[model samples]
Target: IVLQNCMDTNEPDSDGLTPLMHAAAGGHEEVVGLLLSHGARLGDRDNRRRSVLHWAVLTYREAVLRLLLKHAATDDPLLIDAYDESGCSPLHAAIDSGFEIGVSILMEFGVNI
Candidate 1:
């Protein structure tokens, strides 16, 4: 029932993020794919107006980011010019978290300094 549940629970949380959003944010490509197959809306955003791509970058999940990009579900306009309420974008978060590989991955996608 868990898989079925995950398939059905595409609803947003208090922060307005669905299962797909969380999966993408954490770079859970498999989960993201699963949710997508179940019709999870790709354009959903969190309370901060961040899309799945934004969260994926912040979390430094390269696989997830790539998967999202492949699906054209990620634009990440805030890639370099965004800041969360705490004053941090996905890139900033990746750097602050000491995810050097993550920073590099984001750069490959054109996230500016």
Candidate 2:
């Protein structure tokens, strides 16, 4: 597996997007799980300062959003409401993208409105 060979699971690409961010954005649940288990940093942000949660919501990846929420650390309250460079929170992204399920999931996870 690429993970087996790679040293840093949290390493970002030229665009500042980490593998976990990609998997979350693409709705690759299994890959996201694997990466997380392998020590991927959920807090890693893209060049635009979008968290993995943001990518999941922006891409309408509902299942990925749920998975991320389930794995997210409750201690980091800011994680749920992280703002991107454009000032879009995951909840805002979900509502703006018309991802009803995403909005519900984010609300269930306690995201601020």
Among the numbered candidates, top TM-score falls to 2
Candidate 1, residue 45: Cα displacement in angstroms equals 2.1
Which stretches of model 2 miss by more than 4 angstroms? none
Task: Tell me the tens digit of each residue's lDDT in model 2 across 1-113.
Answer: 65978778888999899999999988899999999888888888899999999899888888898888988855355789999999989888888989999989988988887
Off by over 4 Å in 1: 1-10, 25-27, 37-39, 73-82
Per-prediction TM-score: 0.66, 0.93
Query: Each candidate's root-mean-square deviation in Å?
Result: 3.6, 1.3
Write candidate 1's Cα lDDT for 39-85 as tens digits.
77656667887767668876778888777665652533443445566
What lDDT score belongs to each candidate, Candidate 1 first?
Answer: 0.69, 0.87
